[model samples]
Target: MSAPDLLDYSRRWPLRLVLASVGLFLYLPLLVLVAMSFNDSRQTTVWRGFTLDWYARLGGNLELLAALGNSLAIAALATLLSLLLGTLAAIALWRFRFPGLGLVSAAFALPIVVPEICMGVAMLIFFARILPWPAGLPWPLSLGPIVIAHVAFIFPFVAVIVRARLESFNRETEEAARDLGAGPWRALLDVVVPHLKPSLVAGALLAFTLSLDDFVITFFTAGPDTVTFPVKVYSMVRFGVTPEVNAVSTVLLVLTVALTALALRVQALAGEKLAP
Candidate 1:
C-alpha cells in the first residue's frame, strides 16, 4: 500500500476502536443484567448457579403482571394517538407553506427538546390546575392523564421521523398521479401513504418503546391505581434491586431488540422500492 493509504488505515483503526469501546460501554451493563437474571441467588453480587427461577418468579408475580398490562395498554394508546396526530401534522407541514410554519414546527418539537422530568411535572400541574371536571361531573386524571403526557412527548419523535421521510419523497410521482386523474386524497392514500409507511412504523415503534420504558414521567403522572411497568420496577428498586427485576429487564431488552430488527427490515424494503 502507498504511504498515504497506510496512514489512513492507521487513523481508521483508532476510530474503530473508539466506536467498539463505546458500544461495549453501553451494552456491558445490559449483558450483566441479562446474565444476572438467570442467577439462582437473589443477591446481585455473586452468581451462585444458572437457573430460570427469576423468569418463573415473574410469571407468578401478580403485581408485576398488572403493572406490565397497564404499561402495554398505555403505550399502545399513546403510540396510536401520537402516530395519528404526528402523521397528520407532518403531512400538513410538508405539503403546505403556511404562515409561521417554522415556528409551529418548533412548537410541536418543544416536548422533545425539554427535559422529560420537567415536562412530566408541568403536565401534572396543568391537569390539576388548568383542567378540571365541573362539580358533579367525572374527571379523568389517572391513566388517561398519563397516556396524554406520554403522547405529548412521543408525538414529537414521530413527527420528526415522518417529516424527514416526507421531505425526501418524490413530489413528481405524486404530481403525476394527480395528473393521471387521481384526486389529492387518493394520491396521498395510495402513493404517499405507501412511501411513508417505513417512517410511520419506525416512529410508532420508537414512541411505544419510549412510553413503555419511561419511568420519571409516568411516576409524576400515574396515579396509585395506574402503575406502569417502569414505575413498578422503580418501586421495586427503591426497596432493593432483585433478580426478578433483572428478569424483567432482560425481557424488555429482548423485546426492544426484536422490534428494532423488525423496523430495520421494514426500512430496508422501503429503501429497495425507493431505489432507482
Candidate 2:
C-alpha cells in the first residue's frame, strides 16, 4: 500500500519462500502417498483414476490383518507393563533418597539414550540365551520376546514423563490423606493416583505409539513365527509395492497421529490443572 511497507514486505519474501520450500520438501511426499492410496492403478509413479478398492481389499488380506493384530496386541501389553513398572519407579525415585539412587535413576533412563539396535540385540540375547523360562514356553510369547523388549525400552519413557509431572504436584494432599488415618498404600491409591492419572494416560498412549511404530527392535527380536505390522510391511515392499501397502500405511499413519495428538491433549489438561 505504501513504499516503506512494500519495501519491507519484499525484504521478507526470501525468508517466506525458504520456509515454504522446507514445508513442501518435508510434507509433499506424504501428500503424494495419501493421494496414491486411492489410485486405481498399482503403479506408484503413474496417477490413475481414484478408487477405494485398496482400502476395501485390506480387509481380505489375512496375512496383513494378522500382522496388524500382532502389533496391537504387543502394543497394548507393553503399555500396561510399562505404566505399572515406570510409575512405581518414578514415585520411588521422587519420594526417597537412598544409596546409589542417582545411579538407579540413571539406570531407568539408560534405555532411552542407548542406540535402539544395541538394545534390540541385547534383548534378543537375554531372551534366547540367558533368562531361563519354563521348558513348555510357547513360541513368540517366549520366543520372539517382543513384548518384553518393548516394555524394557518403553518403560523409561513412562518413568521420565511421570517423574516430570510429579515435580509440579504438591505432596500436601498425600500428607493430608496420611494424616486422616489412611495407610501409606491407601494414601497412594486414593490421593496420589488421582493426581497422576493424566500423566499416566499420556505415557500409556505414547508407549502404545512407540510400540506400534517400532521396527528395528521388533525386527531384531521377533521370531520367525511373530511378524508385526511394520516388519510385514517391510517384507511386502521387498517383494513389491502395492496400493494395499499405501492403504495400510495411511491407516497406520493416521492412527499414530491421532494417538499422539490425544496424548498431547491429556498432557495439556494436566498442565492446566497445575496452573494458578
Candidate 3:
C-alpha cells in the first residue's frame, strides 16, 4: 500500500535466501550420498555409472539385516518406554505443584542439555561400575542397558514436548469430570488423555527417531551382539564408504520423513480442534 511497506516486503527476500541456503547446506550431503549409492565405482567422488547393485547387495547382507532389525526393536522399545514415563511425569508435574517439582522437571530435562558424549560415557560407567557385573553378561552386552540409556536421553524430549501441550490445556475439563463423580484415573482417561494424545504421539515419534539415529550412546553401551544400524553404519564407515550404506541411509530417511509428516498432520488437526 505504501513505498516503505513495499521496501519492507522486499527486504524479507534475504530471509528466504538464507533459508534456502540453510536447507541446501543441510540436504546437499544427503543428495550426494543418495547419488553415490548408485555409483558402480569404488570411488565415491568419481561415479562411473549408475546401478542398483548396492540395494541388491544390501538385500542379501544378513549382518545389515540383523542390525536393522535390532535398531527397530530398540527404537520401538525406547519410544514406548519414554512415552509412558514422560507422559506420566509430565502429568504429575502439571497437575500438582509440590516441593522439588521444578527440580524433578529439570532432572528429566538434564539429558537433553548435557553433551551426548558425556551422557553416553557416564551411562556406560554407571552400568559397568555402579551396577554389579553379572557372573557373565549375555552376549557380553545386553540390549537392556542400551535401551535404558536411550530411554534416559529420550524421555526428556518426550516430557518437554508433552509439557508444552499440557501448558495450554484446560484443566477445567478434568475438574468438571471430577465434579461429575469421575475419579482421578477416570478423569485422566476420559478427559485429559484425549486432549494429550497428539502430543504423546509426537513425543513417541521424536523418541523413536532419536533412538534409531543414535550412535554415541549405542556405541558405548552396545555389546558385540547388540549392533544397531547406526553402530553398524559407523563400523562400515570406519573401513570405507559403500553404496550399501547409502541405500540403508536412504531407507531410514524415507521412514523418518514419512513419520514426521504424519505426526505434523496429526498435530495440525489436533490444534485446529483444540483452538478456541
> What TM-score, over all chains together, does every model reach?
0.87, 0.88, 0.88
Alpha-carbon local distance difference test for all models? 0.86, 0.86, 0.85
Query: Which scores greater on TM-score, model 2 or model 3?
Result: 3
**Cand. 1 Cα-lDDT:** 0.86
lDDT of 1 by residue, 93-132 (tens): 8888989999998899898889978988887788778964
Candidate 2 runs further than 4 Å off: 1-12, 132-144, 264-276
Total clashes in model 1, counting residue pairs 3 or more apart in sequence or in different chains: 0
lDDT score, candidate 2, position 157: 97
Clashing residue pairs, backbone N/CA/C < 3 A, model 3: none
> Tens digit of lDDT per residue, candidate 3, span 1-276?
788977775358787788889999999999988888788877657879988888899999899999998888888889999999898888899889799987987788788989999988898898788974453555424578888889988987998888898997888988999999999899999998888888888888889889988999899887777888989989999988777888888877888789878887887888798785
**Candidate 1 residue pairs in clash (backbone atoms < 3 Å):** none
Clashes of each: 0, 0, 0
Model 1 worst lDDT window (10 residues): 132-141
> For this target, which candidate reaches the highest TM-score against the unseen true structure?
3
> Model 2, 1-276: lDDT tens per residue?
788877775358787898889999998998888889988897756887889999999999999998998898898889999999999999999999899998998888799999999988887788678974444456436433789889999999999999988997878988998899999999999988888887898888889889988999999888766889999999999998888998998987797678678777877887797685
For model 1, the superposed segments whose C-alpha errors exceed 4 Å read 2-21, 132-142
What lDDT score goes with residue 209 in model 2? 85
- The pairs that clash in candidate 2 are none
